[model samples]
Target chain A: MNDVIITAIQQTLIEGNVETAETAARAALEAGVDAQTILNEGLMRGADIVGQQFEAGEVFLPQLMFTARALKAAMAIITPELKRLSAESGISSSKGRVVLATIQSDIHDIGKNIVSTMLTTGGFEVIDLGVDVPIKRIISTALDEGADIIGCSAMLTTSMPFMSDLIKTLEAMGQRERFKVMIGGASVTPAYAERIGADGTAANAVQALQLARQFMQNALA
Target chain B: MDYLEIIDRSDSGEYISEENWDLEKVAMTCMRLVSQYDLKWDRQNLVPDDPALADRVFAAGLALAVEIGAYNRSSERILRFERDELESALRDMKQTLSMGQGADERVLFARQIEDSRPPLVWAGNPGAPHPEALFLPAVVSWAQEPIVDLITCGTLAEVDGREVRTGEALEITATRRELTYLHQALAHVGRPGMGMLAAQSSVSELGDLAAANPDYLRTCDAHLVPMLNELKIDNRNIARAVNSIEYGMRNGGLYCAISGGLGGDAPGCALISVASMILGLLTNRADYHILHPIHIRHVATSTREVLWVESVVLQAFARNAPAIIVTDVYPKSGALTRELLYETAANALAITVSGGHLEGCGSADGLVPHATGLEPRLMGEVGHAACRQGVTRAQANQWILQLMEKYEHVFRMPEGNPGARFDQAYDLETLQPLPEWTRMYEEVKTELKEMGLDLSG
Candidate 1:
């Protein structure tokens, strides 16, 4: 019966049916399925399928966004239950926390938003600072939230210098060793990433996920 | 509708959060219209020769424009428009406009599908980044091309060896220096009266406002007022339009609809492109339009899907409401490579035959400073040759397919076709193509001729 409810939740998420996804999560919870099992076996599975479809070019941004929305809906219901379980057992359940922003003076956020959605669905806790975000605010927020990584996006060449400034500021504050910094966007090249001392850069959202995961692994190591 | 009314509506119109506006209003509405209009993108037919399909796309686009309108990012409101207002704006648009002064002056006109007249060649490495040292010679390269009727240029990556940061004092300096170099380059090339689409140094309204002097961006030259992704606009571009309109300079509404973004696939992107153009007619008060549909993944306009989107959008406007449309020829590959020439040729053939004047060689996808004058020269040659041969949509499609086969592999590569930088491709002193680059151009020209383009003329 629990397996049936979990499959329903997964199917609803894959179909991007927000209301049904929420209702399915409620049903799973009422049926006594643990929050972690529902998340890992159902929501994450659906998101993984959607992400794969997006990477394969079988689906596009809208589908990815809709699926992410469905995941958000389901996560909203399951988060408190998972928090309760975490408090009881003293175990944290998250891949890693990522703070994302489009650098200052760059109002382009489509790429950043896409990355945020992918990170959320890929099991990372994402705090999106939105576009035209100042480096100071991004650093303060990441420090406040204890984020594991900072992903900065800049589509304009003028805004790219701020990424360097972000690293410099972190180093000045003696916090460069605390978080992994990744940079990307239309104008950001791998060479620019190396020049600015970014931990890594990715060409697209799929690769961005891989890069972020690698950063987390290296952090653990 | 008054321009002030557009601004007032932006403040007072129906409110929707930006997220809801993007997904529900823009994306869902586009998907509904795509189905309602029975529009389907045929991958095999990148340049569809169907007039009825074009008309359907225009109707769907007009409906979309009325439904969603333009979202104001500042106010988070929809700048709603009545169908009559949009129609009136399109009807009253300038059918012909003259650019430049004296012997260099040229008249831009609305082009019909397969129009016999040779399309005006507006050449440049538009929006690409260039070091300060290369800026002057790069502009001169495009200006000196005898086949180029007008010119455009890239932005300066630096000023006096210092990096340019937006919203700073250096923005003003960079913008002014850009125009000064442009002016000097045109005069140095003996085409002092040549018109330009410039002010690329303007990352915001600050640089544009600073460059409004006659010595900088003249009334004769034009500047871009870009619409954000999908159907969104902000105060920065609004300020640019207001400044240019009051200052008497021309405004080119730049709509770069992402192929796989809000609008899905080629047909949906065409729909969004048409709607954006209609809104731009009122919002930007544009004298002309630049169709620059880029792939969401590749970010280049020369892809097969983007070419199809460009063809359909241009055809829709040409058939329904004729306007002066210039297609940006941003290819994936850069200079010193046959792939760049092939991409340029395919883009030129597709756009020129589909009622779009040429403006590009934003090579290497406009990311690197990997562009030079030779690619724009090839763009003009291919565009004029296609017109001279009177190639039909079918013939252009066939040639484009052959050309795509030669370069499409690069898009799949991880390194992404970063061919060669400007300094490596051209001689700094003479501002001429290097030997190897010229050889690649000649070889590509020969191959294109064998494919039935009349290059001899």
Candidate 2:
């Protein structure tokens, strides 16, 4: 019965039926299915399929966005139960916490949003600070959230200096080693990333997810 | 509709969150229309020779414009438009635009598929960043090209060695200095009266407002009022139009629809491009429009998918609306390489044969200051040669496929083909191409000639 409910949740989420996904999550919880099992088997599995489809070019941004919405809906219903279980069992399920933002004065967010969705699907808890975010707010939010990675995006060359500034500011605050900094955007290059002292850069969202995973593994090491 | 009506409607229209507008109104609506029109993107034909497909794309685009309308980011409302209003705007849009004054004056008119007339070359390294020292020489490089009808410029990465931040007071200084350099460069080339699509330093309306003078950006020049991704606009762009209306500068509405973004693939992007153009006529009060469809991954128009999007969008506008459209040619490969020329030739052929004026050789995807006049020279050369030979869609597609084989591999590489910076490609003292760069250009020209693109004209 639990397997049937989990499959139904995955199907609804993959189909991007948000309300139905939320209903499935509630039903799973009512049927005494562990919140962690629903998240691992249903929500995460659905998101993984959507992400795989997006990477394969079989689906596009709208479908990815719709599935993300459905996942968000389902997560909202399951998060409280998961938190209760974590407190009782003393085991967290998240891969890692990440803070994402488009650097100051750059209003372009499509790329950043794509990375955010991909990261969320990868099981990282993402705190997405929307477009035109200042350096101070980003650092403060990362510190506050205990984030493992701080991802910045800049679509304009004018705003790209802020990414460098972010690194310099972190170094000045003696917090440079605290969080991993990864930058990507139309204007960002790997050379610029190295020049700015960023941990790494990615060409697209899939590479960004891989880079984030690599960063987390390094942190563990 | 006037700018006042646009503002009023922005504030008074039905409220919708930006996310909802993007997903539901823009994405969902485009998918429905794509299905309704049965618009399938033919990957093999980068430039389709089907008039029926063009008409269907136009109808779907018009329906999209009427259904989705423009979303106002500042007001968080939908700037609704009746079909009649959009149609009337399209009907009233200027079919011909007069730019510049005196000897360098040029009139840009609506072009048709297989247009016999040589498409005008608006050359420059548009929106690319340039150091202050290289800015003047970069503009002069293109201005000295005899085939270039008008010139555009990149943004100054620094002013007096200080970084220029957008929306800050320094932006005004940067914009004015950029124009001053542009004016100096044009006079240096004795094309002082040449029109320009400039003010790229203006990341916001402040710089645009500061540059509105006879000394800098003149009434004869044009500045961009860009639409955000998909079908969205903010007050900064509206303020640009409002400033240009009374100032009498030409407003170029820039719609850069992403290939794999909200509007799915090539066909969906083409439909969004058409709808964005129609809405831009009403909201941006644009005299002319720029079709710059960039790939979501590559961010370059020279990509196969982007070239297809540009081709179809240009054809749709040329066959149906007949508006003055300029297509941007941004190649992933930069200067001092044969790949840049091949990419330029491919883009020039596709755009020229599909009824659009050419505007760039924004090298290295316009990400870095890796552009020079040599590629734009090749762009003009290929464009004129294509017209002179009366290249067809089929022939152009074949040539484009050949050219893509030369440079499309760069898109897959981890570090893209950022060939060389301007300083490396040109002799700084004379602002002329070095032997190595010129040799590459000559070689590419010979190869393209062998492929039947006669550059003898």
Candidate 3:
């Protein structure tokens, strides 16, 4: 019965039916299926398939976005249960925490938001700082939240220099070692990331998740 | 109505989230319409040879425009248009624009596919960031190129050692400085009355407004007002559009639609691009449209998918509307290399055969200060050569696919090369390509000739 409910949740997410996915989440929880199992075996499993399909070009961005939205809805239903379970068991459950933002002087943020959605669905906690964010604010928030990684995006060639400025500021503050900095956008290159002293860089959301995961693994080790 | 009325309408439209408008409405609408029209991209043919396919794509784009409309980020609204309004805008749009005066005078008009008239070259280091000190030399490099018909120089990376701020005094000063440098460059080349595109340094309306007068930017000159990607526009853009009209300047709307963005793939990007050109005409009262379908994965327009997108979008405009169309060739490779030449040649060929007047030489994808005269000179040269070859759309598509294979590997480079800087690629005093860069250019021309592309003018 629990397996049936979990599969229903997973299939609903894959279908990108947000309402049905939400309902399936509640049904699974009511059926006494554990929160982690639902998230791992159901939503994340569905998300993994969606990500693969997207990578393969079988599904375009809109379908990916719809699937992401459905997964977000399912997560909303299961998150409180996750917190309660963690509190009862005296353990925290999350891959890592990420802070994402589109750097200053550029208002383009669709790519940043997509990365945020991907990171969130991939089980990492994400704090999106939105667009036109200054360098100081990004560092302060990352420090305050004890974020595991900082992802910066800038779409305009005019605004690409801010990523370099961010690294310089982080180094000057002597707190550069505390966080992993990743830079990307349409104009950003992997060499730019290295020149700007970022820990890593990614071209898209899927690669970003891989970078974040690698950073987290290195941090934990 | 006029610009202010359009602004008011933009402000009064239905409120929606930026995500829903860009991701849901634009994406889903374009995708479903693609399916409804039975529009399937032929991976083998980058440029569609069939007239019916081009019409179907345009029809789907028009349908999507009517259904989804454009979003206004500042007002949090959807700037919906009526069929009659769009029709009237199309019917009344000035089909031809005479830019500049005297010996440098040129006419920009709506073009059909395989239009025999030579594609006008609007050459410059568009959007490439440059040191304030190197600005004049760089501007002169582009202006002095005899093949270049129009000019729009690169933006000054700094003014008095500080980054340019939007709506600030720096914007005004920098814009004036940009025009001064452009004027100086033109006079240096003795093409003093050359038609130029201006105000690229402007971060807001202040620069355009401050520079819109005849002294800085002339009535014959054009000013750029870009529609933010995924069909979003702001008050600053609106103000610039209106300001240009008031000053009798041509309002040029720049739209760079991205794949994996609002548009899903080549087909989706083409559809969204068509809708964007129409909306740009109605909303900005634009005299010409610069349509660039950029691929997000490589940040370069020389790839197979981007070339396909560019061809189809330009063909759609060519076949349907009698509107002035200008497209850009953003080479992923930096200047002074054989790779840059090959990429520029392929991109230039695609723009020429698919019916777009080329407007670029964005070396290193406009990231580095590495742009030089030779690549743009090559763009015009190769474009004119392609035009003379009587290249068919199918032939251009096949050649483009083969050509992309030569330089697409560069996209895999980790730090996209800022390429060789201006000083490295050109002689500053003479504004000519250095010997090594000249050698590379000659060698690539031969290589292109060997590949069956006619380079002889």
Candidate 4:
């Protein structure tokens, strides 16, 4: 209920711990705090601080892991509470939905996970499909979830063909225009993304969030 | 203070004095790497003359140099290949070929065959020669299986002894040299430049390698070894090395490159390979190009642990640098077979494409007295074709899985004639393909193309 949640979240993000952060979140929820309040005020605020630390190099990968764990734990407790609050308030108009998955044939899930966390912090509904996903399942999931944006992750040069093939599959299924596509990973160059024909490609997590928001806005316009 | 800080003291914690230009911090770090890895530090023992285990060990390491070097270099984009689908695909591919099962090498064009299409060289310790002029022939010649790119230009030799990097002086020289070389090299090769990489080297040595009179090159590459070692690894040395790369780029400017060289070894150190690459990246010359030369590991099955250590270091490096990654492409064992060669190339390709841009060295056997007569050109041919794959790292890696299927069992030894002078592959001087071997090369090429590799282009 106190800054302990905030400090713990901060510590957890960098250290990549999911367990202890989960404990902290459960405790925060038991403290009678509103779910939305913990999410925006406690969880997200903690992630933002950790993001800056990473930016400043005050902390590195180990610290970021802990931070992610803390955030995930806090988000777990707040999801139900937020739903309940929305129902109680009879509110509407939340952020759009995003389907995030690491493409099939590639098991590199770290980049996708980081991007998913960033998208969640942006308040978008992120549905992460994990790594090494087949093209068919991704297309099916996007259609079923009614996702507005589809983010495909590939970290291998060998696996890049999957990205192109996934797009081709979406096009074949007549669902290509239904969702915006985003591609990313370390070996992914802008030239490659353009060559492969993804609607958008981000270099890193921060860039992913910016592009995602922009894509949705453009669609609306 | 850290190591850099400690090195800074040599320069009085200021700039490198004019007297101490061209030293390298990477070379300094080489000492520690050798001690840690417990590897021998000489290339001469490439062929042991005695029964000494140390001599044999050096020969083993040299053999590995061919394995790693000629094996289809790559080590960037590792994340893409780190998937279950890719891993499973390789597992399945290895199972298909009865010979697959070894820690030494394999070819990989992708994480999965489903993802493995062609026109992409995922891993080929490719040549990125400076001077864009080499493009037409470079590309044409490179159209073969393993050769991948032609880095048009990079850093030059020297500028006011400060090892000129990132300035107008470097640019002027690079552009001029590139124009001169491109016009001539292309004229002979007959192709326009398609893909170019950054040039790297000392501009001061422009007049030197231009003196590529075999005698001069031999001197620069070998004789000047002692002086290069004297500069000890430090920031100034790093700067000098960076500047020299800048000079190499200048000589072959506008070709696109990430700078580094082969001399990053401590005068006599076993870890020269890693040191050379680390020095190249630390210079903040990411914009121009990228350079990474994976440390060599011995081919001896007894030394598998040593090889892994080098691989892990390269894995870390793959995440750190942005430029294309180049690693060894051969397996290093004298017992290598054509099938095993393909498999090792495939495995090395898998690691390279996933990890980074690979250089397919065709590091086919050479240097040994009997290891001769094994065609180095075929090695180059495989390199050129494999490099053009452009497939995903995981898919490219799958090719290694395919190769391991046929070659892993032979990592230690395979087959040989009763009167064989050497164990398996031959040395450089004797590198010639018997008609049967030539036919085998043709057969492999056709088969790879059938797999959708599209090497004919």
Best by DockQ: 1
Chain A only: list TM-scores of all candidates.
0.95, 0.94, 0.92, 0.76
Candidate 1, residue B387: how far the Cα is off, in Å: 1.5
Best by TM-score: 1
Q: Write the per-residue lDDT of candidate 4 for residues A78-197, one digit (tens) a residue.
A: 677778788889752345789998877555554676677677656678888866678788888889989999998875444566788888888888878898989997446677778877
Better of 1 and 3 by TM-score: 1
Provide the DockQ value for model 2.
0.74
Best by lDDT: 2
Q: Which regions of candidate 1 deviate over 4 angstroms?
A: none
Instruction: Give the residue spans of candidate 4 off by over 4 A.
Output: A1-19, A56-58, A90-96, A104-110, A120-126, A130-132, A155-162, A186-197, A216-221, B1-136, B139-457
What range of 10 consecutive residues in model 3 chain B has the weakest lDDT sum? B162-171
A44-156 per-residue lDDT for model 3 (tens digits): 88888887887766776676778888988888999999999999997666888998999987788878977887787687888988888988999999999999899999876
* TM-score quality measure for candidate 4: 0.37
DockQ for each numbered candidate: 0.79, 0.74, 0.42, 0.01
CA shift of A15, model 4, Å: 5.0
Task: Kindly report the TM-score of the first chain in candidate 1.
Answer: 0.95
TM-score of each: 0.98, 0.96, 0.92, 0.37
Better of 3 and 4 by DockQ: 3
Candidate 3, residues B75-173, lDDT tens digits: the string is 888988887777677787777889999989999887778767778899886777788888888888878888899998788767889876554577788
Residue-level lDDT for B131 in candidate 1: 91
lDDT for each residue of candidate 2 in A1-221, tens digit (9 for 90 to 100) = 99899999989868988899999999999999999999999999998998998988788888888888888899899999999999999978788899999999888989999999899878889999988899999999999999999999988888888899999999999999999999999878788899889999998899999999999888778
